[model samples]
Target: MRRNWAARLRHVTIDGLRAVVLENERLRVTVVPGKGGDVVEFLHKPTDTDFVWLSPQGLRDPRDHLQGAADDVAQFIDHYEGGWQEIFPSGGAPSEYRGARLAQHGEVSGLPWEYDVVVDSEQEVAVRLRVRTRRLPYRLEKTFRLRSGTAALEIEGRATNDADLPLHAMWGQHIVYGAPFLRPGARIRLPEGVQVIPHETAINPPARRVRAGGPWRWPLVPADGGGQSDLSVVQEPGSPSDIVYLTGFDEGWYEILTDVGMRVEWDATLLPYLWMWQELGASTGYPWWGRAYTVGLEPFSSMPTDGLAAAVANGTALVLEPHETKVLRLRAEVLA
Candidate 1:
């Protein structure tokens, strides 16, 4: 008996933008090089499940789309067709660095990247993507690989500060999950001794259950109406939009299980903090209009979503001395 080609790499244009597809026997992963090198689609083929959440507005090419307003934050959110964005240099709100302003989640997520199909074999396939930030003196490179017979996608990345002066930046992986894969009964699993800290304020006040407090122990947090809300269990649709931080991880790994499951593991030292963003139909205004339901499991080198300036102020930002480079690795595996 002979085996067919188990791993392959292909390219296609998605919504007027170039995208690269890498797949094995179990998973099909799509990378959009023209839009921030985002992992727009991660499909578990056997189950026909896509774990990535796509914004209702869908992917829009910034080059072709006309802006309604001249806001920096809108520039990112208006085009935020949620998938998996590699946030760099700034992770949250717009902030100033050396008198230059960094856009919300800026310097990378909205910029186009250059990619090359570095490996194309029957047993494995890989692609390398590189990008240089427009407003910052930084260069980032990463390669994504998928191997035959494996359901895992491996990513190796390097971030370099190309300037002569020291640079501080907030780097993160903004991976989100939505409907079809995420639902009321879905469960989340994290490492032991993990602590959860709710954002001081709720993004959707009316729907939020967890009160703003804690370094609370794992899943159960003090609910607003005086009970404990379980963090491990996914809430029903129309629940609150909230933000929380998970810290004190002995290791960096998480599992989101529905009928199918996804397990993501990364270097804890490289990105020690995990931000859990729940926007399960609670945001009734602006971008979402209560139409989106998604959960973001983000790994970061910083805390809070207050941008690089805040990360630096709080001592959570990744600092690179002139010409220094930091390399990191992560893997996302699909489980049946």
Candidate 2:
């Protein structure tokens, strides 16, 4: 019931200096600029409402907003079914596969950025992609400011780490929405004393005490495969759990509930963990068969897989000595 990705895009192009091509209503949004400014792409066309995607293609996943080659980085665990993306490499840089040592999500999604085309707002269209990570000396600034309004996206960032590894990293803004734009009234709003963690349910493999409490309620307890941990979850618009959650948002500002409030707001104060991933078809453990509709608000400085060794064993995973500079700020708010 949304139906209007900026009046079907009509056509807008700079094509690629850094990239900027919005063509709504069948949706084809590409705003790329290294890790931080990465919305990469999202193509879905059901017959061109005016034009969403039919003139620019290279979508395997990651929204088909395809932003490859700065070095043409590719390695989603060795082809995550072709096109998952790669390029965030830096100092340690060395991963072609196998458990993955460094470059998991550090640097800037496979570095090689510095692109520009500006207008910022009021519909002149925008694109600003800057990157710096010469082996982690640290300096990242990404701005993919696009405007025509709601289908919605906004992100302005900064990160300065003057050399020193104590900078454990994990940040997420991987938004993937498809299947008639995830129809079914679409709902997923966070912050209200958040707490939701659902990854174990193959008859309970090992999820460990259900997120323990803070922002709890997703598959909170009770699942054979009926679905219920949080109440606003909807599937069938795409039938995959289209809304997604993994919350605890406050200073990180998060809210999205499609179907006329037309929303999307994510502001990361150094990312405090937010992941609302959804899956369908056998549900999910992702060994793969496939089902539609997607969601992943993933913003993290730590919180999964030893979370940087549990933030370095309870000291809060951030330590920079020998000539250091640490200043981080992230903001994104677009509402209608």
Assess every candidate by TM-score.
0.91, 0.30
Alpha-carbon error at 112 in model 1, in Å?
A: 0.6
Cα lDDT listed for each candidate: 0.84, 0.41
Total clashing residue pairs per candidate?
Answer: 0, 18
RMSD of 1: 4.7
**True-structure lDDT of candidate 1:** 0.84
lDDT of 1 by residue, 1-336 (tens): 223469998889999999999988899999999999999999998889999999999998866546446487887888899999999989988888888798889778888899998888888899999999988899999899999999999999899999999989888999999878999978888876666665653232112222222223233232343444466778877776667887667789989898899999999898987899888876678979989889999998887787878777768789899999999899999989
- TM-score between candidate 2 and the true structure: 0.30
RMSD of 2: 18.0
Candidate 2, residue 316: lDDT: 31
TM-score of 1: 0.91
- Runs in model 1 deviating more than 4 A are 1-4, 65-69, 201-228
Best by TM-score: 1
